[model samples]
Target: MTRSEATASTTGTPEADEYDVIVIGAGPVGENVAERAHANGLSAVVVETELVGGECSYWACMPSKALLRPMAALADARRVEGASQAVRGSLDADAVLARRTAFTSDWQDGGQVDWLDSVAVDLRRGRARLDGPRRVKIEAPDGSTHTLTARHAVAVCTGSRAALPDLPGIEEARPWTSREATASKEVPGRLAVVGGGVVGAEMAVAWRALGAEVTMLVRGERLLPRMEPFAGELVAEALTEAGAEVRTGVSVESLRRPSTDRPVTLALSDGGQLEADEVLFATGRRPRTEDLGLETVGCEPGSWLTVDDTCRVKDVHGGWLYAVGDANGRALLTHQGKYQARIAGAAIGARAAGVPLLETDRWGAHAATADHEAVPQVVFTDPEAASVGLTAEDAERRGLRVRAVDLEMGEVAGAALYADGYRGRARMVVDLDREVLVGVTFVGPGVSELLHSATVAVAGEVPVERLWHAVPSYPTISEVWLRLLETYRG
Candidate 1:
């Protein structure tokens, strides 16, 4: 059926209404789950307390990318001599912020609500919790409570929240989390970022370009440590060149603020004091499973839920409770969460209809097999870092017979012409026994788009010999694939 046909028609009393499927958390993941369940001829309803699109639509991905894109564009222009000559002055912070506001629709959920209505999935604007098996209780905005029942399944898609480190006075310091960092209207004169992961790295690059003296304190040895060593090396070089002071092996001993208007004082592990107009903690994320009433079903609260290939919560009788997205902790990425939602919805439909699952093998419609075998990510910094599947370190740790091939992206003609003195690197981890690419990493300007190609290779498990026939266009950065295959052959 068409999406518009799915808009819920009427509202009945909560006590009288029962659906085939009930989804918690109206984020992208939950929306997809409801749509998929509806497609399988099951009635569905979605519950959300925040905006329908969740963190990604209002705060995380959309606003963060909107804030970073202008800085990246300016940097790209300044790299070429011809373009560099015409470019002048720092970015207009007000304009960039205005664009971000527009991208977020001024924190409104009208568009998302309309989309849900178009899809025919019922939307309940409230916070929801599991009351018991297939039963949910929602606390509405007006202080009224309503209960919902699911005839077939109840899916949890609450996603996750930014985790802050424990420190004295951290609560009183009024430090910025990712929500504040991405949505702030004004850029601080001096910004200090904690942690060296994707959010920290991208915000440093963005704020530094917007005229903030950014100081990035990483507790680890380098930035992007989860990727190849060279990825962090290239990103650090670029961030330093862009005027961000990146400190590695650093720790925050204490945090203090005399007044809300005053700068934050940070005591370092090395017995030094640092101060900044604003401090951001991009440390990590914790699943949003707490207080979801998991304890009602003999599961632990405030802990990640475990699920099977079909996303059914393990050890639960009858296989009716399902968890997807960050709540499951299989893969934290939004796209991967959506993939799990699709598989879970199909499994629910099959069971409801008493139709046995046709296939549970790899890449099956009822299994989230890709979460383990292939997961792609892109860090949208000035020099973008993109990768898919296993890294060389991961392959080695897993005892796989693998070889890592590295290439300087400056060797590619398109990269050379893309910027003057372009600097970047590419690496491919090849499985010796299978003769197929197990992983790929690209670090350079304009490398974000190259990630999908690598994802296809790893996900498809296409043999290296067969990859030769799929030639990349000449004078393109993608030619690095040919170079990588050639190096592997030798």
Candidate 2:
């Protein structure tokens, strides 16, 4: 049958309610899962309650980065000699918001929907939940309901939602989550950010540049508690230098907002009070599985699902239930989720064909080894911090014999030429037993582009001796690689 005919037969009628794959959520991860399953000769249908492109497209990644770019460009220019002299005015907040809206296509998902149609993957606009093993029930917006049975597998890709802290009068305060913080159209005069994670740090930087008096309240001793100590230190220092207050070891005990037009009053655990036009709680995220009908399949609702290397959920009796992306509680990054989806899709196809699962070993076509060994992340604060694989602390905790080598990025020629007074750091954690890079980190201007090479080294497990033969071009930040190698040798 033709692709369109196949899709119609699978989703057009109540009698024809079976597909090779039933994917819940239409975010990037779910889209990839459906597309890959269809490519592998399986009919697939995706169910979504929100935009097809999910959080990254409309709110988190794209819009947030768009809002950040203008400020970053201006900051980069001021770091140079001739450019600094030419730099004159502050950021255009309205223009920044417009550009951000443009990136999200003004919060419309038509383009994404069209792309799905072109791929011949069926789309159902609704909320989905597991009825039982391999069975999914969708509740459409117009109060219609339909049930779909997966001949092969059901994949859950519902990502995550912002988790708010339990404090007195928090709900009444109606504080901003990451969604509100990224999608806001206006710049608040005085913005108070609680939590010093990636969301908190990036929003503080973006809003401060957009002319807000930004204050950061951190419950921990420092920001980015999961990354290396210096990463948070550098970001905190930069935020402080940029006229934002970074208060560590403080928490919001309570919040009060008398009316919509009034500012928010926060009672602090340190026995102080502060007021701000808006308060953003970037505390954490919880899996979007609370109402996903996990209880029907012997799993708890609202809890993260555990999966194997091939993304198969362990709690389910049959191997037909899979959970990808944030729902699996693995790496939460969009890129990593898509990677898992690809592997999971292939595994489902191979099993249905009654063929041996292809190369189920580490780093194989059916394995998601990267989720554990070589996950990479980039935080886009000024002097962006990027890291791949493990951190020094992670390595030590894992009981690996490792040594961390560090170098001042300013000492590199390319860095000096890039910025007048370059201030950043680079570190590589070497596994002593294997003589390979177990982890790598770079914190400096324009270092986001340097992440792939680190990811390659860690994922490929390139030996230190072999790395010596791979030469770096002169007068580039990548030359920091040579410096790192030299430091490791010494």
Candidate 1 deviates by what RMSD?
2.4
Q: In candidate 2, which residue ranges exceed 4 Å CA deviation?
A: 1-15
Clashes of 2: 0
The C-alpha stretches of model 1 lying farther than 4 A from their native spots are 1-16
Q: What is the lDDT of residue 265 in candidate 2?
A: 99
lDDT of 2 at 273: 95
As for candidate 1, its clashing pairs are: 6-120, 7-120
Which lDDT values do the candidates have, in the order given? 0.89, 0.91
* Candidate 2 minimal-lDDT segment of 10 residues: 1-10
Report the C-alpha lDDT of model 2 over 32-87, residue by residue, as the tens digit: 99999988898888899999899999989999999888988998999999999999
lDDT of 1 by residue, 421-490 (tens): 9999999999999999889999999999999999999999999999999999988999999999888888
Candidate 1 CA-lDDT value = 0.89
For all predicted structures, in order, the TM-scores are 0.97, 0.97
Candidate 2: C-alpha RMSD after superposition:
2.0
Q: Give the Cα error of residue 346 in candidate 1, in Å.
A: 1.8
* RMSD in order of candidates: 2.4, 2.0
